[model samples]
Target: MVDRLEQSKALASQARLSVLGWLADPQAHFAHQVTGPPAEIGVCVTLLAARLEMAQPTVSRHLEVLRRAGFVTVRRIGKWAYFQRNEAALADYKAWINDHL
Candidate 1:
């Protein structure tokens, strides 16, 4: 349907894909946080921005695309936004690709 097509389009960007890959292994990809852990809440947006070597706004836009595609989930802790991969959504995406392509 149109929604699925739109979701597919949302994931078509390289930056979004990189975000997903980084989120896949948060512990390995990101540094340890004093607040707690990367796996507990999720990786912080600032950390993601630093790792990607892009501005926070640019990283945020890429995160938004991945979020719309249902590939990432968001958590708000205090004043920061954390992001992590959505395993179920990713599984669904893979299945859809297998079936449609």
Candidate 2:
């Protein structure tokens, strides 16, 4: 019983942390259309920086946080780097939390 509780506690903490990480960078961590509706893919670093009125390096640091947490993925095209949510991993994590908690 103790072990099970401990495991659940750990998982709950991790799930909470992951959600925080995913939202850490609303612009850099997500992609959507500038107007009208949101896009299927996330935004690139340059675009995110423009939207946030921040520097590329600053946005980069936030992206690193999300990437390390397994909440986002990065892709490079030329000199630009794009980020997208790892939907599968996030979905699985949410499912686990919903089941255990």
* Best-performing candidate as measured by lDDT: 1
Reference-based TM-score of each model? 0.90, 0.55
What would the per-residue lDDT of candidate 2 be over residues 15-101, giving only the tens digit for each residue?
334434544554444535353112334456666666566788876776676666565677765666667767675676677669978
lDDT string, candidate 1, 11-56, tens digits: 7877777788888888888757666688878899998888888999
lDDT of 1 at 46: 90
Give all candidates' CA lDDT scores.
Answer: 0.84, 0.56
Q: Which ranges in model 1 have alpha carbons more than 4 Å from their true place?
A: none
lDDT of 1 at 64: 86
